[model samples]
Target chain A: MFPEELKYSKEHEWVKLEGNVATIGISSYAQEELGDVVFVELPKAGQEYKANDEIGVVESVKTVSTLYCPVSGKVTAINDELSTQSALINQDPYGKGWIAKVEMSNPAEVESLLSAKDYQSQLAG
Target chain B: MLKKTALYKNHIDLKAKMVPFAGWEMPVFYPAGIIAEHKAVRSSCGVFDVGHMGLINIKPQTSNIKKAEEFLNKIGTNDVSKLIDFSCQYSVLCNEQGGVVDDVLIYKLIDHYIVVVNASNTDKVLAWLSSHAQDIEIEHLLDMSILAVQGPRSLDVIEELFGEEFGFNVLKRNNFLQVGNILVSRTGYTGEDGFELFIPLEEIEIIWDKVVEMKVQPCGLGARDTLRMEAAYPLYGHEYDEKTTPLDAGYSWAVKFGKGEFIGSKALSKEKEAGPKKRLVGVVLSEKNVPREGFKLFNGGAEPIGEITSGTFSPTLEKPIGLAYINNSCHEKNISVEVRGRRVAGEIVTLPFYKHS
Candidate 1:
């Protein structure tokens, strides 16, 4: 189940916007499909990125997947705890496993992301 | 289209994540996850649907033991004579150029020998045997299915199911016994002690359901890979391929250099004298970064040495482990692996990253 407050991407990432800074992490569905999260690579703070840019990577024991930015922004902060406790993504992807915080370069970019209902439909199909 | 085994429906009923592997649609893991299944195999009993492995029975010609011994020795790298009755031996089928065709397990029965090969290389191995072996009756038992029940508690589960029919106490490692129509062997791919039961396809579901009823964890290929990697067992495609030999995979002991005429014996002997191009070694990462297959390896400095063949996070050891074939010159401790363009410090350690005491 996707949270109503969050916007989702087709790549299974979720974003939470508070004013111009948007918090991002992979959805619970993504983590569940990934089985166990063994490692996470997040973009460094102050790094600028465009929408759909490959910002980081997440690795399970069997697979490696690239993480894409859903909105154009500069990385204001990243979850440092993921380096030691990547399982947090599998345990609680929405809360403690939040990957990064970006200072949105274009506030209008949030409208391009899927709503919770749209994300649920996408997963259903 | 991918082929499905007899247990495919059962895996789907349990909500397993299915993936295509070696032409078969097999379960990669279940909801309990890979680490949980791996721990089950290491700590207790776990049943794997290895139905894809090929079972080839080489019946004796004129019931002559010498002929069977001679035929097997020609194809196998390990000495077939060392195998006692009801025992199993690991060997590889090599080409004339000393490259491995496929790794196999030869089981010596009372009247015939059975060779178990990788599912993907079954046809290739059969063709190789057919061309080299003369007058030996080679029967590909495709109707049979294999179930690898592994761990310390494997016999306990087997005893619960077939206690009255068979005795588990006498089945030593690398040995097998017949119970009714099934062949139960004390051999497994995992380093853990277990039994590999080769049973008829029609009756396999009965044993599979019974084992599941006893709460033996039903593992998939995902856990199988991690467990074997932790045990330091070389996978066919990962460690050795058509161009890689046993010696290149750090299995020189399996190749008897001075043995009688056999396939690749001459080339292997020459390579032994001249030295191999690369050597396989176990690498343990000091950082938490998980090194994956094809990730580049470097020596203590920036000089690129080789690449990783198989890698995973060892659940038992609680560290990242990998297997790589580094250049012979960089055969030292304290190497580095480049994952995503960043070098992570790694130390070359001995094989069998996890061993049961």
Candidate 2:
């Protein structure tokens, strides 16, 4: 169930660009693969991260997975609700489960991300 | 190639997430997820398709029951002579080095004894039993299927399925009874009043469908592991391996030394007198980070004390809990586990993180 407006990465992350700030969260497929999310460790705001850097950690009942930064930028905000309710990622991966918002440092990185159709094909392949 | 259980098609119909485990393509969880399946068993009722476990029968060549008992007693850590008809006992097979070969449940039937071994160690245990056979016949029941119905409401589910006249409600724990073609045992891995039904391969699907029709949640191995962990049950390859003795695994009560000479008895007796070098202990982490298997343990020092054997987030306790084999020398009050290369503070707690009262 890939949203049409979202850009996706091979690592199963979805990004939504609204001007200079890009909202990022794991895809619905990633949440399904992780099972029930029990805990999440989000990065602090104002911290800068390069593309493909480890941005956060997601822990489910079975295992843990590392979330990667899709675009190099400073973290503007993170969803603080995940500290108490990590299952939001499973319930709403596109909306309320957004992990972080990054103020982009390199806008050209968006072109490298796959569209919703391409990302769905990548998952099938 | 992975082996499929009798309920493989049923699991697929339920939309279960299948994963490879112990050479079988088993369902790890259903669409309800592991946490929900776990909670359902805790509060209501849940069914598990554990047909992957091995069932080996030890029958005497003659009508002499004593010879069969003696043979089993020599190979197992527990006393087999104490088992009465329709009763089962938890025991462990050990190597000569005092390490565990596999933990099993020995069910003594009228004419023969059935030993249920772990799925992964089925072939090894069969060969081990065959090598030690004297006048005993060790037959593997490859076409058997095991269904475990567990929870607080498990008795009700059993009554609903088999009817009240069967008297399953009165069946004592660790005891089994033979129905027409099925053998029902009042035993389970989950810390709950439950029953394990030993059904024929062809009959398992019908029983499973009936159980599901009654609104019983069908659980997978993912929930099974968490349920057993919460109950502090020692699993093979995790707490008890070829190198881990029953003494080190906190299963001393099951090892009866007064039963006379058995496999690994001399070595285990020596270890008992001197005490185990390392002991399995439960640790509760202060943080939410899970301490996985092979993670190093520290006692507030630079040196590592031991390593985790099994770790998971306890859905009931809502905390990260684990079992570790810490060196007995390290008696520090505060311990830490290295999780993802970071130290997380923890404290040693009593076993069975969650007990059903």
Q: Candidate 2 at residue B95, lDDT?
A: 97
Model 1, B1-357: lDDT tens digits are: 998998999999989999998899999998888999999999999999998888899977788876888899999899999889888999989999999999999999878899999989998999989888887989899798999999999999888978845768777888888888898999998899999998999999999999999999999998999999998899988898988989988888888756687899999888888899898889998887788888888876666898899999888988789999988767679888998878888888988798878
How would you encode candidate 2's per-residue C-alpha lDDT over A1-125 as one tens digit per residue?
Answer: 89999999889999999999999999999999889999898998999999999998998888889999999999999999999999999999999999999999998999999999999998889
Clashes of 1: 0
For residues B273-344, could you state the per-residue lDDT of candidate 2 as single tens digits?
999999989998899888888999998779899999988888899888898999977787689999887899
The alpha-carbon lDDT assigned to residue B80 of candidate 1 equals 92
Error of 2 at B162 (Å): 0.9
TM-score between candidate 1 and the true structure? 0.95
User: How good is the docking of model 1, by CAPRI class?
Assistant: medium
Candidate 1 pairs with clashing backbones: none
Question: Each candidate's DockQ score against the native complex?
Answer: 0.75, 0.85
Best prediction by lDDT: 2
- Cα RMSD, each candidate: 1.9, 1.2
